[model samples]
Target: MHKEITIFNETILPGESKTIHMQIAKLHTMTDLQIPIIVERSKLDGPTVLFSAGLHGDEINGTEIVRQLIVQKINKPKRGTIICMPIINIFGFVNQTREFPDGRDLNRVFPGSKTGSLASRFAHYILQEIIPHVDYAIDFHAGGAQRFNAPQIRIVPNNQELKKLSDVFGAPFTLYSNHISGSFRTSCDHMGTKMLLFEGGKSLDMNQKVTDEAIEGSKRFLKHLKMLATKHQSMEAHATIYITKSDWIRANFSGMFHGLKAIGTFVKKGELLATISDPFGKIEHKVKAPHDGYLINVNDAPIVYQGDAIFHISKELE
Candidate 1:
């Protein structure tokens, strides 16, 4: 580890921890838009992990998780650096949106160009300043509008380090998905940084249970990485499922959705997961499971349109 590492032109030394008020852009009112960064470096050198959330401003569970870590001082990196960016998309966060002010999804325009949309500019800054120095990372997320995803870890295949971290994080389930081009994870991938996404709860709200699990999993990860002391005794023996395939049971007809199951429910093949009915209840469209599996997520919204995702079922592991 170098005595001093420069980030955003500000030099940070080992055995130091502070909030870096990095100015990334300016608001319309000429206010200085800043990205608040909390960097904690250990006295001894080890892996550098970044815990970032709120890439999509509306996804606030991640923001709350990072805030909890900071306020409680849970991130005691004994052997490495921890860069915590609780809210990267302050603009979108302020507006309670999933995209930038211009409606571009920040996450979909990663490793962005200096001269691009608000989302792209932010992404560009992050890539230029953050990803190069990170070894491992986790971006917290939650279900989008009108959706509630169960607490889970989402990752790409073939990343052993990410897989190990996901296992140690110990989310109730791990979902394997393909990498998206121009995503923050993909950008970090290009930089040889292993990053995983943690999904839970829903947007624009707080769930204490999910938050607790996220914090616990993060602590467990630190312990496994030898970056923090093990305050926990032996962990419980939970199966911690690895789901390889998942399908969304969408509505066959536009109507009101009545979910028959919630997160953590197991359904049998052809089981009725939900019922879609007209406002008058004149006609009902049954939404059934295609296969036996664990129901990981369910639509929180009562109203639905044809083709809307209502139930998310992960194929049963044989």
Candidate 2:
């Protein structure tokens, strides 16, 4: 049943849309920074779904996806609430950095404390304020700096409902990732919240393909949740595989890396995925696949240090 949702000490009634400005912390110059949340509730009873992005401030695909939702006004929740927090790390977002200004990853300090660092304090506040009111959540993510991730969903394994949503979201692949310490997924899981983490594109710049997929997949998900009053466009039916086990292909030598394939390409076992060569280009080292799987991520930067995870592969079932 749909219920009254509250965030940042403000109550949003049914069939209402409110932007709650949450002041998380004071800057070094004593200026206040706020996390703006957009809450849209429906006239009928349904599940409250939360869509968040920019936990790593540099990932702009999710931020752009939310912006488009607001621009198009497509998020008319017919029965439940839709909470949109596009940019969570305002400090890092403004600074064009992934972590907080204090150099701690915002995603690593979830279920945090009030007296902790800037990131932790913000995490604690948002986790306490917004997550409790949410019945389902989808946190958007992407590859770290100098890397790119194929569009995929990372879910906690053995959860059928979550698995069905992951499939309905229509990503080509799904990853069964473990919960990391202090992560947002971990915190939500502890609170018994069902959530999915979508990773696509790369850091900084927003790729059009990834962004389009995100928007389409999100609309499909909302439709599946019965939030939308009408049916969404029919996305092409494609087999979605689960990449249960994955590993990163580290650079064998300190040199320039030349990728053989981009995201979404399936490589065979022992296939040449990339080549690492010295600056002079006289000597080279090959980075090949140890198993047949789709390439999820590849280092974008040319120069890589030894043992850098430039390529990622996961074993999948067709």
Candidate 3:
């Protein structure tokens, strides 16, 4: 027999999925909202998987990916559930900004308080109402609008269970990063829930390659966990490099940029990465890598200023 679970004032039902818009605050004639959501759950009982995106509203690729996943008519899980919340910060999404209307970063205010700030209250609600019920979670993201990241999974290296899940996600790259305080991942880890962060592309834009990778990787995750039937022909493995540490290459002087390298390229120390030139085409400044690593992210546009970040290099550990 299958049992359905409902949450948040019965607005979300397990067997049926829909968007639950919760009013967070009202500004005279305007009202701010947060979207509490639940996707259709499988009829059988098994592990529950949560897919969330748009914690930073402008990072929209993940939102689209989750939307596509929920609509996909795959064979029902033999024993499990899938809950997807494609957009969490409706305020930010409406404004096309990364932070909330209160200027708080929703991603940084996790496991929040019941009577705290708006962000904190939302966090508290998610922690109390949702996190307790999930066996695992996948939080999707992309680089901010001004930057682009190569498709990758971010997981903690020491956590063997999470590492296995990251590998099973099957992205082209993985980053072993420690959880920071007040982050959703850290809060989930404290609650003993393993969460994987999927990052790619740029904010507010859809890259077909990134979208395809996310869809394929998520299906692979479902198969690995036995939440979906495994297809023999859909088992091709992709190469993934593990990097334990990554750093940004910043502009040394203010000028227009002429990039010579692309994202996902391996670079050695002292490699010419870009050239900075003045408006008159005089006094060209050469930008080079300070160390050897893979360029997993780089600024795509040519215009830049002093101290602007141009490249993100990840040094492989395993």
Candidate 4:
């Protein structure tokens, strides 16, 4: 049997389930704001997996995925521990914004200082308290703003272990990315935790398809670690396309935007992808594909400004 685990000064025995309320700071109204951390541990010894979301408060799709995992009892592991933190940035989530009350992006602050900004202190708390016990983690995210991203997994290139895990999870697309300084993924990596960053849908919106993809992939990931419960049968997954290089397609004109191409579809060179026209119905401009590639991100906004990114296409694939 595995030994007992402690979080936030509360000890959880093997095979026990507990919800720890992490109270960092109070709201302006003098009310306590608690971040609920749900933990489930199996009596048998195994890996500890963390499924976290809502790092950006507006990215509700990720939060929905984690919530479904809990509702469906998928977080009840067969021989390991499962921890779910559905809303990391509860402050931003309440305000429907992407940043903290201080306007600092939580994603940009990692392994933070105890005596720093509110966001930084929270970051420090997470790394110090939760990350040490995590063996593998899947952090969910969605596109920032109005850009709709096709369901995808992102990992740093040249990591064979992560690449193998990505193959097991089987996201439709897996992109190679470098570690961003002060990002949670980077900090996790430094702490020797393997993590897969899942991105899909868009901020402040929820898509059923995106949620389904993330949940399926998560099940596959758990199964690979021999931690999935017997009741849930892991589904067969398609081979994920590995993207080595990509670039954003920017709008050439400022106007009311009309996109013609769907996300996750390939387009030929110079093919018409979208149209930008003046609101007055004069002087329309066509946005075409720079080359043949798969469109992974499509802007959903009705309006576009010149040089605004409208599409993100894979330029090189593996």
Candidate that scores best on TM-score? 4
Rank by TM-score, descending?
A: 4, 2, 1, 3
User: What is candidate 1's lDDT per residue for 163-240, written digit by digit as tens?
Assistant: 788888899889998889889988988898888789999999889988988888888777777876444432542557
Candidate 2 C-alpha lDDT tens digits along 144-218: 988899989999888899889898888878899889998999999898789989999888989888878878788
| lDDT value, candidate 4, whole model | 0.95
Ranking by lDDT: 4, 2, 1, 3
**Prediction 4 TM-score vs. true:** 0.99
Better of 1 and 3 by TM-score: 1
List model 4 lDDT by residue over 88-111, tens digit each: 999999999999998898989998
Q: Name model 1 segments beyond 4 Å from true.
A: 229-237, 316-318
What range of 10 consecutive residues in model 1 has the weakest lDDT sum?
229-238
- Give the lDDT of residue 231 in candidate 4: 94
- Ranked by TM-score, the better of candidates 2 and 3 is 2
Tell me the whole-model lDDT of each prediction, alpha carbons only. Answer: 0.85, 0.85, 0.80, 0.95
Per-prediction CA RMSD (Å)? 1.7, 1.6, 2.5, 0.8
Backbone atom clashes (below 3 Å) for every candidate: 0, 0, 0, 0
Runs of candidate 3 exceeding 4 Å displacement: 1-4, 11-19, 26-36, 74-78, 229-235
lDDT of 3: 0.80
The residue pairs found clashing in candidate 4 are: none
Runs with alpha carbons beyond 4 Å of true place in candidate 4: none
